[model samples]
Target: MSQSTAAGDAVQAMMRAVVVTRPGGLGALEIKEVPVPVRERGWVRIRVKAFGVNESEVTTRKGESDPEVTYPRVPGIEGVGVVDEADEDSGLRPGQQVATMMGGMGRTYDGAYAQYVSVPAAQVIPFETGLPWDVVGALPEMFQTAYGSLTTGLDLRAGQTLLIRGGTSTVGLSAATLAKDLGATVLSTTRSPDRTGELRDAGVDHPLTDNGTVADQVRELMPDGVDAALELVGCSVLADTLRTVRRHGTVCFTGALAGQWSINDFTPFMIPVGVRLTSYAGEAADLPADVFARQLEAVAEGRLRVPVAKVHHGLEQVQDAQDDVESGTAPGKHVVVLDD
Candidate 1:
């Protein structure tokens, strides 16, 4: 249930959150009552309505502790909620709906897995009309990453050929939809033939399997070779992706699902043919705000569909949601819906 900031002064505040005491699996996450967040200057307390889960969050949670996280942390990267409190000095007001991507939440900072969270005013953004719970919830991590890859990491342009390796993933589909909207030809890959129709509906011109022949398939589609590649499949095919690019073409490798790859040498026999290889780490500020707004508009207009792979109720269900996301049962995105 939504709460009002006006009541902040009168009551003892406590909220529920999903916390991971130690990173292992879903069993490590537990629901507990925590203090309601209070806004600091230039920050606002968000009454988190929904939070989107991603694979990166899962990996970080289970991996060895690094400098970014200590034990007993909340794990949520992106969130959508109403503004509970705002700095009067700033233009923000209470009750404005907003969203934020994974700058620090759920990693180095407290995140939206709780009923309430405090984030910088600049990080919080107001939403226009028609922003749905599912869509807004889904935007933070995947959309921002896609925005980063296409705009910042790779200077994707109209009429270029893009090979998206993970066609059905949240980030992968976002890239495909974004490229198609920008007037580019998007060729994606899926592990299942059953996903072909869905990929087509999502605007992918061609879909292939990860059978080590994606390069051959891509060559058949474009004799000139792909202009760029969004490599979600990982480093195992780095050479293959490079081969698919035209002479002097670019390859933006984002994620590594294929396994560990160490590039000891950048110059190989391919140098004679001319291919550019670069590693991409999501979006930077290079992606314009108007571009992100356009994607949001598409979601609002039904052009972008944020399918709920699975919905788990209550903070206790956070682990189940994580499991579902990892298991890949849900089609698009996995969301955790807190009970009012």
Candidate 2:
């Protein structure tokens, strides 16, 4: 515990943070005391209370991600916290509640792995919430991806039929939940037969078990194909997902859990005519502040729920938490809680 300050001239404070000395194993997770970030014009510093562990972080930790991911970096992509310092023009005051995520976080720059993070004011979304820090921390990326993929990527609508290609995944389950909330008949799939119940509990109406040819299985239920689909498994299953939708229907490619990043033998004819194909990838700045704020409001009002699969206190368990998620044992979201 060291005393440090933000902006250097006025206040002083200190904070704890985790650093990845290099991309490797759990040994890379190093916790230490660091200076509280200094706020700049058009930027704000947050006192992080909690953060979420994402698979993207896992890839980065293993050195298998982008070459731009420099090591000895603080690795956190999303977090919930209070404003430690902000200029009035930032539209946030000290003590204001906000969440920080994506826009170059944990990759192009130092991110939320610290007790305090200074980020672009646009990337810090202000909101009102009484939810626990773990829950708030876990919601942004998963639900925002869920909401964006459907609302923007696929342009999903009420009374539509949606098939989540990899339903048991966190994002898949989140898509199912949001689609159901939008009045769609949600159908989801799982590679594990044992997890069908989990998908159903998450609001998936028709839970189908499939290893390959998931589209064939879907065809059995929806002979004319669904109204829309979200291909979560990536290229290996994308063609299958595309076929599961009717002519002129929509399909959004959002995830690549199957590890196939590119499509071989891909041709224009392979995609159905008039069948819209779209993808969603965004930074924190790309995510509308109003969208993030609305989700927080919905969760506080009990109109929505962001299920955290597990919550580990302190930065010490970050490695364990990431390993657990990599092992595919986490049921939903894994959150890391920090003391206020």
Candidate 3:
């Protein structure tokens, strides 16, 4: 409508989308024809090519997400696609490759679970890559969280020792790959002994089994404790994770993979004396354009991996993809690709 080259004028007004009528089990997800979202002044409409199925969406479907999530909503926090429409001043042209995530998406408003999504211009990240749609879709939220946690949350540096508490998760695997590339020694944990090999293949230096607690094993590997630790298992194991860090080392909490959000009795003593505690819940801008482009190039050139566990073909497989993610049957990112 704003004279963008890729405006959707020739496309139909109605498109198929997976809608959650209300918070419930997998049965709550239903495929229905919904009007394509209209482009607003400060927003761009994306013809979604692919999107990753994340645990947060699973929580949204179960009605366990933050109070911001409402019924009959589309559930997707991250997507990669071409712009269908944009205002002339938005710096985004129609058909420009882009990615969007985490500015109240899928919760406060409808999100990428549809054929098209309208998102604020500020939250959209533009990039150029030759990677496939499924691979690119898996990168946005997973890579953003991992990159932000390492650089912003931990200030991780080369030659340092880093520990991932929930090593088998998509973010955990992403962090391990990035940390390894940064020349850090990675010690990652997994509850399943079978998945330790997966961590090793992801360039992890040490793969520790997580039987609820991993501090003892971590200390055994690094007598002085790791230089930094990433807490993805959540508050339930935050105290033990703190013990895995050396004096003055940092621990950054970024995910709640164990589904535990808060500790009943939190206290200052729960943290080590000289260790710093931080958390990362960042937006799209936290992952700079240069960083995103470089990572995409790395993946394209085979210097890095996307760690995609599976790729579902269309909206019909959305439930199956969510089920695989919720069940943890796969240890990496699950993506849904919408083919024309």
Candidate 4:
């Protein structure tokens, strides 16, 4: 049978959807019944089991995403679930477990905050694992971003000293765990001194509080500066973070939680000779399937960790989830689970 014909053989008509009607706070989100997405020739429909509540989604809800983000759209860039519909030739089939993330999802296109989501077939990552929905749901986007940034962006080595400037964030903790596994000495940071223990338990060898002189504190510890630094706080502190790296150290900017976007006054001379500065904004296709599968294997084998700071029951609780993520008090990421 043809691909489209095969997809037409099994599908549902309508499903529940959570929509952001406008750029507002939590009140703007609407949850109601909506038409089920039709599977295009090379697209796959996922029966979303659970999705992570990302800070990006929170920013989008507050009317602060990229200028091109459209209203009345779903605001989830990551999710995990079963394939409900797929063209036969799409290399996917009903009953398969998969994940979808990045690539205009929850930004310019309908996202995973719904009962169903249709995405390009190539973006549907297939995997086999016995992990529960909630645990696996939190992996796709955050872990892939962490893995890619560590391996591809920084080219991290086994014996280097690495610093995560925003270590308490979900992705930051993931990097700490992975870096520890790679035999790197990991130093992490949080704005609050109380959370230093939390970072230690998460495998951070050192946890420094950010008090405007964080670079000085790091220098006190390393003396020669770190081998690499992952900048998550953004341009406001980019220059300071750059100074905390060694002569030939690598610095990769992966996030902007500090409200500074552009480095308008930047100059190449600002960087020390032999230092390298790079940034990573992982796209949907940026997380490779092979790398993701290896991580999943590690998770299943009890070597890797997925630390969910909080869990909300269903779509109705997504507002609470986002509220917590915005509060920035959670030691880990918040997740919204759909009861199976």
TM-score: which is higher, 3 or 4? Answer: 3
Return the TM-score for each candidate structure.
Answer: 0.88, 0.93, 0.96, 0.93
Report how far residue 214 has shifted in candidate 3, in Å.
Answer: 1.4
> Lowest summed-lDDT stretch of 10 residues in model 3?
1-10
- Model 3, which residues run further than 4 Å from truth? 1-12
lDDT for 181 in candidate 4 is 80
Ranking by TM-score: 3, 4, 2, 1
What is the overall TM-score of model 3 with all chains considered together?
0.96
lDDT of 3: 0.92
Clashing pairs in 2: 3-13, 4-12, 4-13, 4-14, 5-12, 5-13, 103-284
What does candidate 3's lDDT look like per residue over 1-340, in tens digits?
A: 3222375556537888999999999988899999888788999999999999999999999999999788889999999999999889989998999999999999999999999999999989999988889899999999999999999999999999999999989999999999998999999999989889999989999999999889899988899999999999999999999999999999999998888989997999988889999999999999998999999988988878778999999999999999999888777899999999
The per-model lDDT (C-alpha) reads: 0.76, 0.83, 0.92, 0.86
User: Candidate 4 has what TM-score?
Assistant: 0.93
Model 2: lowest-lDDT 10 consecutive positions: 1-10
Predicted model with the maximum TM-score: 3
Winner of 2 and 4 under TM-score: 4
- Measured with C-alpha atoms, the lDDT of residue 91 in candidate 1 is 73
Model 2, 76-145: lDDT tens per residue? 8888899988887667888988887888889878888888888888777788778778788887778778
